[model samples]
Target: MLKKPTSAYVHIPFCTQICYYCDFSKVFIKNQPVDDYLEALIREIKAYEIRDLRTLYIGGGTPTAITARQLDYLLSHLTEQINLDMLEEFTIEANPGDLTEDKIAVLKDSAVNRVSLGVQTFNDRHLKQIGRSHNEAQIYSTIDSLKTAGFHNISIDLIYALPRQTMADVEENVKKALALDIPHLSLYSLILEHHTVFMNKMRRGKLNLPTEDLEAEMFEYIIQQMEANGFEHYEISNFTKPGFESRHNLMYWDNDEYFGCGAGASGYINGMRYRNRGPIQHYLKAIRETNHARLSEEVLTKNEQMEEEFFLGLRKKSGVSVKRFEQKFGLSFDDQYGQVVKELRAEGLLSEDKDFIRMTKKGLFLGDTVAEKFILG
Candidate 1:
């Protein structure tokens, strides 16, 4: 039997306002069946057998956008399905402006120990350009409130290489982020996905993103600045203080299965990866009819699983373990990936010790290219 997933990811697809770059399954929080959706969400959670969960992540479209009473209902029901004591990390994604004192109090009373705020950037102009509703002041106030609420394990996300953004802007953003002294930070380069406003602008030659070289410079600068400030570059886009790394995300990079609940959520269970229907009405209807909302499910083949192990594991600073890969796949890691590994290492993109094969510093910049080589014929 496949091992039960010890992690769960709950998606709350409601947003007060959507960002220009976001393409996640989300809807505005007006004229929707909010209460009924919560009921269906809880019912879906109850459909699974209750067990101890090591990590639970409540991600967005902005979980904090709802009223405190609604949040209370969601969290209370969530706790009923999993024992709180066994939960080492309980995280909730929030918007800085949406985290009212009442909402913070609700989180404080619950088992939520970590909060990932969508700060995006400290530049107000960029914030407005990106359709983020929160300003720099709201970010500071929100962090202060979270600190007052006894939430020390806080993290904020920053976006670099934005439209018309300069290196100086990134420097300013990083300076402000460091000044906050938050325990963890995630910095991502801007990606233009299909159907996003930014992507349409780019297609029309209306968006002026930085050149590839400048973007690389910004990334390097971020890594350097973060390291100077005592933050560990644990993943490609993630930095953390000692013992403050995101355990929930680590479960993903480790390629472990997890329960993905709520509308538009994706889960991996029993060697199968599945996603729920993105539309709220569709998800609710499916859940009410069958107690599950899976829109599609695929059981990974052995080769696919092996490829995933390398793709996900290589994102970490420690890289992929040769022993673990061999033990899991019942094949020698060298025998399976010997040629690919030799080519990457020859190009100075990978290095291997006895236990692990990891990316070199240069390999970090070309992570996707390196990871793609691990695929079998």
Candidate 2:
């Protein structure tokens, strides 16, 4: 018999405005076609009888962008097959602007044990600079409201490395976020994605961020501050209080199979990878017309999969177990990829503990470059 998948992710693509730096597939819809999307989502969920889903993450442009009534409707769609009561974690990604009193109530009622709120920055100026809708006051209010509504397991999202985002800006934002004392945080270095308004502005010489040196300095600074505040830098981009790490996200980083449903969602199953067509109209139509994927799909090579295991496994602070890696790949790590591993370790990029190969602190500071070494070209 086929075993049930461990996790699931549902993507909701509706957003109020597309951020200038965002590369995510989001639609600025005046009238959200959520009713249509929900029908398709139900269809997709029904097609899969994988009932023992250990975790379910409802994320997006923002899941809370829909109404409280819609949230209830969504929970009803999956409440039966999956063991919500026995589930380890259920996470929802929400925008502060979308969270209301009623929505919080619905989440609590639905057994959504965690929330990852999109609170990019507490400063209003940078919030406007990044095209984020909420301000500092709104963030504080949202946190307060969630706590009052009995949601303690909350994670807040933040971004640094904006064009004018200074060291002081990073410090202020970190301090403000820590002051909230949420159990988890995802602090990201800003990436200037192509075709975005920010990209156009940069090309026209109207925007410039701190140099790579400065950005690296910012990452180091945030790391120090977070550690000083008793937060664990669990993954390169994530920090958390003791025992509060996001289990659903951890599954993704660990390369475990998870279901992705709704527009532009990706799924990993049976050693095959696939993503849906990002264009909403096509995605909606495909789900209704045929049970087919309109996006790219491929099975990875053994080498490709092992290299992925190398890079992604190192993301954890605990790092990858050499024994586990061998078990998954049917070969010893020393037998393959050992040359590159030796070179990196000689240069102090990685360290080996009792049973794992992992990145050093300096290697983590240059994590993108560190990760690049493990990518199979």
Candidate 3:
């Protein structure tokens, strides 16, 4: 018997404009074979034979950058065979100005119930500095339009500690974000990734980023303000109002398997993790020949799996479930990492109840450094 993952992620790799700090698998939308790519993506999904799903997410360079007709075609065929009653969430990522009236109509007619906007910052100058196509006014108008169209399950992404950013600037960004009244928010600090414009500028001594202490202060302010305004700091970078947490994202943090379709997408299933061909032409050719576009796959060892369990699970505020870990891996959590846990607890980095182990506020500030301590190898 084969077990199928209940959650799936579909990637759309086209964007109207590229940002300075983004390194995701994306290319300009102009002159690309958009229809051919969509057809190939559908072919790959159909090969999976997915019939029921708990969640379906369409992420992108920008999913809404395509034409309304293309969006409609993709959504319709994607959901045609899905068990809608069993699907808990259908999310699509969009830019601020991309969701025009025609596209909004397409979304309203589809099964998509959630929209994640890339509103990085509310300052128009910063928006331009970051290479974002939309301005502050467009964000407000887009949200207003989405709400008026009766779609309120919204989330926005904000980046802090940006180049030349000040504490006062972060405070104003947080204030504007809260005023939008969206149910979910993902706030991330600027990380200079390899091959990004920001990284290049940093290498040339042209990028003026905040100091570590200032960045920490910005983080603390965001957590405090979001909590004060009634949002749960459920995950390190995610906040939600009550039950609006992203179920698809939760699946990842919980270390559950899911399908990933389209170019540059990754998936975990049958104890194997795999990524598809990233180049559009390569992906289309592979899918056309074999109905799948897997470029690489790795079968995780038990030790590797356990390491990932701790690494991903520790990102959540609730942390890892000791009982669930024991049940899944058939090993006593204490026997394996009890010494490590004790050392971290002694240092005021970790705390434990009977059932779960969680990171303290001090520990969360260090983020990956604390999780790295649990790596067995």
**After superposing candidate 2, which stretches have Cα over 4 Å from the reference?**
292-294
lDDT by residue for model 1 over 31-134, one digit each (tens)? 88889989998888889764689999999788998899999999998998888779999999999999999999999999899999999999999999999888
> Model 1 clash pairs?
none
lDDT tens digits by residue: candidate 2, 305-357: 77777677788887878888888888867867788889999999998889978
lDDT of each: 0.93, 0.83, 0.95
Judging by TM-score, tell me the better candidate of 2 and 3: 3
Go through the candidates in order and give the C-alpha RMSD of each one to the true structure: 0.8, 1.4, 0.7
Ranking by lDDT: 3, 1, 2
Better of 2 and 3 by lDDT: 3
Worst 10 residues of 2 by lDDT: 287-296
TM-score of 1: 0.99
Whole-model lDDT, candidate 2?
A: 0.83
Over the stretch 1-377, how does candidate 3's per-residue lDDT look in tens digits? 97899999999999999999999999999999999999998989999998799999999989999999999999999998689999999999999999999999999999999999999999999999989989999999999999999999999999999999999999999999999999999999998999999999999999999999999999999999999999999999999999999999999999999999999999999989999999999999999999999999999999888889888999999999999999999999889999999999999999999899999999999999999998888
Candidates, ranked, TM-score: 3, 1, 2
- What lDDT score goes with residue 349 in model 1? 98
On a 0 to 100 scale, what is the lDDT of residue 65 in model 3? 98
